[model samples]
Target: MTAGLRALRRRILTPALSSTSLEVRGFRKKNPTAQELLETVGRSFLEGYGRIVEAPDSQAAEPRLEAIPREFRGFAYEGAAMACSIMDALPGSGGRRLSGLLAGRGGAHTYMAYVGIGWAMARLPRMLHPDTEDTDPLLRWLILDGYGFHQAYFHTDRYVRGQHRERKLPWPEDQASYAHRAVDQGIGRALWFVGGTDVDAVLALVDAFPPARRGDLFSGVGLAATYAGGAGADELLRLREGVGAYRPQLLQGSAFAAEAREHAGLTVPHTHLATEVLCGMKPHEAAGVCREQRPGASDRVDMPAYETWRQGIAGALVSEGRS
Candidate 1:
């Protein structure tokens, strides 16, 4: 594509910046700093998305994405991944754009990239969703996580306020039944943003959901709180206390965030603080827990390896009395 055509493609594909504003999304503005930070995340995501769509390829977009500040670079990569996946899914655009990016520098941000694919899924039609049948079974669930977050973030009335649950997703044919749980995890993450990082409000929203679903929901909250860093020490402590019996699950989510941040070399001060408060360990230690408990390839088919990995991390936290 010519530069002009690519620029036009970017403009057509990218959502307007105003769409991310707290007022525009009908999300709360608990405080100015929190609102600004969250809005900045949206802006950074769009910047990344625009860069990838206008460039010739993911590699061609790297230098500009790399120019993003360290604090929000991961989100930019996420936006880029989302755009690449969207491009791959579009008819007549030769596929594998996502795979090629993943094989290159995007490897460091694998977790975010997969979530980005989920974002693409939200925008594309069911028939056009990226193929994940051959994706790592253990990590493909993260795509649903991304999808859930996208739904809850943009369609809050249905997924969050109405407390709707996705049932038996059509993708991942063999394990479709487990899709809703993964989606709920993403919803939980979005709730953190929806509530504007207000611990009490977010907890109230979680409590409103059916008891059975709260565990996965809390897990998402933990991941967002740790990775996104909107909540403070006291708020995190309150969240830890509020979760009660789901503490292990919450810690598991925190560990997942820690692992992603650590692996990508994006650990920030809030990551450390959140891990310390939520997981009773440093960010690296929490990430180590995730690494130590990751499940290897297994013939067992009763549960997805992804679930096993999560259960293992949660169990490890419980066994060590860290929860």
Candidate 2:
């Protein structure tokens, strides 16, 4: 790690740049043994990244758990769990490297590592301030709220990739310049604050998809959870409830395509891992879903469209006096 990278990561920690500044690291290859990957993951945590490691794998068919080096145990279960999910999803068919699957698609671990950190930051407040009233609307509505909590709790970001740009907000008018800085810096810390393993669990599940696919999935599903009792509470709730009834079939590839066409008007296409987080499905569920829906699926998950829809909906809800 260079001092430049460290300073950059810190600078991004400012509230204004938090959400937009995404920290992507780890995974130089497809399946860089748990030991090697864990080292970088630990360094990332120490570097103010987030503390998340994978739990010991129970369903590995090959390379048995014993194969993992003893020294790697020091890393948190959250990181280990995420690593297992990434490794488990590689292309090999039967755990074979599948060459391009890991490297060609911008690296699964990188996507997940960033996601894991982001997830933790989003959830951190709950772990620390369990009882405190949340003053931050962003933290309260998106991260901690319960209702559509199903979507936000897990792989929503697998669809909603954070975008970077200058923007203004209605609240805290005096601190209007803070939005960009918040996305860049505070977002990471927000995710990290969520605690380690819980965040890792979400990423481990989502990391299976390629970046583009992840974005696409999130975009199609549109908005999930948003703020309540502030500005757009009523309308936002209506939209949330409208979206709440829709459920993913848990099938992959063509089914997703079919569902997209079928529900084109009513449902949004999101790569939301409902089964994984709520039902406690195994990590491989992500791989299974992707394998079924996306042919030649790379490790990328799309969040572009989902994000666009979110901003649009949020703005609409706020303006209509429903927030």
TM-score of each: 0.97, 0.23
Worst 10 residues of 1 by lDDT: 168-177
lDDT of 1 by residue, 1-323 (tens): 89999999999998898988999999989899999989988899889889988988888888898898877888888898899989988888788778777877888999998889899999998888888866776788899999999999999999999998766564655666578888999999999999999999999999999999999999999999998889989999999999999898899999999999999999999999999998889999999999998887652345878888999999997788765
The RMSD (Cα, Å) of candidate 2 is 18.7
Clashing pairs in 1: none
TM-score between model 2 and native: 0.23
- lDDT of the candidates, in the order given: 0.89, 0.26
Global Cα lDDT for candidate 2:
0.26
